[model samples]
Target: DMEIKNTNTIQYRSMVDKLIFLTNIRLDIAFVVPYVSKFMQTPQQTHLWAMKGILQYI
Candidate 1:
């Protein structure tokens, strides 16, 4: 679990937005997207990595 303070807020927000948009059209990542999106305001490196993994899957 990575700390939220050290993670990139901008990138995390961007990715979460993208994932939310994608979730509207893609069902596969819907579950993970919401799980990770829960930390939108204060995301960690681990959350970012999880989002990256989902993005890579797509």
Candidate 2:
């Protein structure tokens, strides 16, 4: 199991926080947002990619 850590956890969390806030207005992402939020404590590259995908989705 080779897990790569996200270099910018702060940025990742910030984005996730914003996504959580957006969930109130964009119900489409409500489900996925929480899914990604699960990795907030120790986000990895894959997690960050998921977040980016969410942004693209919006």
TM-score of each: 0.78, 0.83
The positional error of residue 2 in candidate 2, measured at the CA in angstroms, is: 16
Strongest candidate by lDDT: 2
- lDDT, candidate 2, 4-23, per-residue tens: 34446877899999999998
Q: Per-residue alpha-carbon lDDT of model 1 for 1-58, expressed as tens digits? A: 2444645877888888898898878988878877887888877678778878888999
lDDT of 1 at 30: 78
Predict model 2's lDDT versus the native: 0.83
Q: For model 1, what is the error of residue 8's alpha carbon versus the real structure, in angstroms, after optimal superposition?
A: 0.7
In model 2, where is the ten-residue run with the lowest total lDDT? Answer: 1-10
Residue 19's lDDT in candidate 1:
84
Model 2 ranges off by over 4 Å: 1-7
Clashing pairs in 2: none
